[model samples]
Target: MSDAPKAANPTGADPEANQPGLGDLRVIVANHLKRRLPGRSTMREDVAAGMSIAVGNVPDGMANGFLVGVNPIHGLYATIMGPIVGGALSSTQLMVITTTAAASLTASQPLADMPVEARTGALFVMVVLAGLFQLLFAVLGLARLTRFVSYSVTTGFLTGIAVLLILSQLPTIAGYPVLGANRVMQTLDLMVHIQEVNPAALGLAVMTIALARWLPRTPLRGFGRLVAIIIPSLIVALFHIDGVQLVRDLGEIGRSMPTPDMPSMLRLAPGVLTGALSIAAVVT
Candidate 1:
């Protein structure tokens, strides 16, 4: 065989050389899987998990914002922004430190009367502080301190939170007032007004919760929660239970999207710094 260097393409280009797209990325991933995993299979569970997280946040963010004495839109903004910022700076790959209903409620108690800009400034500060703390922790090699909280303690804490979540949503699910600006007041108020509850609304709420719990296991379960809410809500609407006490409607949905604004630094100062630090502590 003659030793000859391979000829460069005379056209000096390959048609598919720089055509980078999702399919190309997928092909690369498939090749990686073929080499690394060999026989094991995965259905992109991470994609599904991320989607679930995104969808789950919509209702939760709105509800939490309402509970926290802030516009629901802000809660939604926090949900979107928190994840991106947290993901970028956090060393932990699996951390999902978005605003929780309880955390937001706690933090907002102090910041309630503050101006929206001030509150936002506070949130920014808190995120920055939290990021700094995380970095410090990493540098200090104190990440292992998390292990001091025993597994059982962690489990119990999470379990208690789950229980609280189920109990706290009782009013929303039962079509009654959530009561109180804080946890104690809300709980007490619910207890006091337990007698004046609406049956149809309550029934609809229960059905929605049940469907949300069970429907995901079945094939057609994807739309189960929607079906549960819509069907019962429609029935309630058609019946008109009291005529005096009516189901609240948001009314006239809009299709237009809002414009985005650039963020400012000077807007966030001392109060924001304090508030953010407080919030970051509570979060940790």
Candidate 2:
């Protein structure tokens, strides 16, 4: 039987058993929880803000999942969990931690080659791996590297992502799924088949965009996006609009929360590993 006390690292940054200290993540969270609670007025504002964020994310989350080539429910689930986890660990105060179109686009690339049935499981694995990579970056304190990245490179990267996202959505907006080797080729194919565009779907998409832009100027600004989703959905149902795809069209959204599943070890190969690293880089 060993009687010697375990060695304690002075930094207490790691989760090792012997190194419990103020720097421990658990301690930090506990301290945060014990801090002065917000006053009633502040709490009311927080609740209102949270509700607004939830309403706004309903469509955005599903859209992200759709972009990832998986069931939209998964994205909705991410919207639910991502904020809880992100808020817990987040170091910054200015940003809202949630999914983004760029990261979704980056995630889609890896799943593009996967079968429909397999993509969901593969996505789960990829996400877990990406989280690990991001954690590694934090542990290594590599955030300082971003300071050295050139302004031109950052600007170009963002512009490229935005342009690609816009091009990628053209097919959906046109109610045509133009299949090609990549987004650029698909966009070209979509351009070539301009006559095949569904006027009904295009009209609705335009109206939705207009609503998104116009609503933000009024008192209903905070609810604009949420209303945009609901309004188009009601019209789609009432008119029985065909050709345009939807989140529900991709897969079933269950009535209850899904059972948590283990990430598929089969998907941990080099290709997926690279995809995970790509997602991590884009997300960070």
Candidate 3:
């Protein structure tokens, strides 16, 4: 045949021009099935995992923010983001992901000295630095080093966190913001001022914790945490109980979507730099 320029693809795409035939297509799909999608035969597993995480964690996510002396909304964001980002990375075990509460607790340590107004911005920069450290660690293949950390040490560390968490929460549960040098002292002050505890708040807190404990044993176990969170809220709304402080009191919730913004390096650096390294190490 006489040589002539081949017709351009209708979409002006090279991919369409050299389209593979059925045999080649089968080979490509087979390879993909065998390699990239070996365990994930369908989207159902991912959907179920997402639902489980959201339902189980959202309430605690709000509380986790208080773990670090910030707005519960910030903890709420971290709780939501942890799974979405960590899962996208194909992390080995979703159940073991403690980045939401534990990491926030760790991050709080460095920001404790910063002014309340400056803390949010400084926290954002520290998050960026922490993410960078995670990437650096992965690239350096330092993840394997964590396997050597002793089990007793790990248990002790987590036990300490749990105790601290309980101590930190006593003030909120009792509706008395006690002041002291540490959580232990705050807890002691709370005990001393036990009579100042708001009856309605204390009752609601007890009810919520009871439900959280009791719900897990029932047939509706999957939604236990969600139910535990909602029941107390409904009771407060229905009764118009004034003693208990609602989450809305902490800050106004935005109705609009968030806009992306660059962190102010100059303004935040001084406040965050000292804590950045520590946060980065913990996060990594």
Candidate 4:
């Protein structure tokens, strides 16, 4: 026999040849699941981190849900279920799945036309459809399409989203009703009604914003956002700030855990499709 070792398989074949039919798919699935599983050594740390993230994310999720005109409890539900399901299936340990301002804003547009009572069902459909589209994209290997989007375009898009988020929340922050369907009209309406702004509400908003910004610089930074929201809210309540609205004013928050149910597919309309696509695009 020659001293030299046999040449390696150019096709990356196993030395012990096995059946190629279902074995390849099985290997793929096994590898996927393996990546998703937490290692025994890191289990404690993983659980701690997950708990921290879940708690830290609740306020933002609730805000997004409110902005989307849904019951605030829906936001809490989205935050809880999303991370658990996403964490279990995702390959990356650090990947977080939660409601975002952009997704909520995009979803709100199409939902604007629906009756207040029916908006919740429409929101559910939009979210489900968006998830389905994402799965379709993954199966079709369309992730590479993102490469065609230029960096400048992405920056501008994100900047626009940030502006929209600020504008959308301005009414709430200023203690006024969201005046118009479009941002331009809303801005104009806000300007026209500038004198009607509630002083107490504005002060609370200012205090919350200031604390939220400054608290992170302190030693207790981990709880900055939560404290920022809670302290201002407590002060407002204690002082009995007149003309200031609280979350309790919106509707009764559901106390129980959310259960899964099918969305009303019969209500799907052309506008709903457009909104679903917009949400998926923003999420991606």
* Per-model TM-score versus the true fold: 0.55, 0.84, 0.77, 0.82
Report the Cα lDDT for residue 151, model 4. 68
Across 1-284, the per-residue lDDT of candidate 3 in tens digits comes to 97985432233343432433524443443344234543656688867766776788777777777667666777667766666776555423313354455677777877676666667677777888777877888899987686566668878988987887777778989999888977788898998998899988889999999999999789767688899989999999998999788888876666653455666677664646656666666555
Candidate 4 local lDDT, 100-143, one digit each (tens): 88788889888877777778888888888898988888898987
Candidate 3 at 144: error in angstroms? 4.0
Instruction: Give the range of the ten consecutive residues with the poorest summed lDDT in model 1.
Output: 243-252
- How many clashes would you count in candidate 1? 1
Q: List model 2 lDDT by residue over 183-262, tens digit each.
A: 88999999899999999889988999999888868888778887888899898889888776777778788998788888
Best model number under TM-score = 2
Candidate 2 regions exceeding 4 Å error are: 1-35, 267-270
User: Which of the two candidates, 2 or 4, achieves a greater TM-score against the reference?
Assistant: 2
Off by more than 4 A, model 1: 1-53, 79-129, 139-141, 163-168, 171-182, 221-284
Best by lDDT: 2
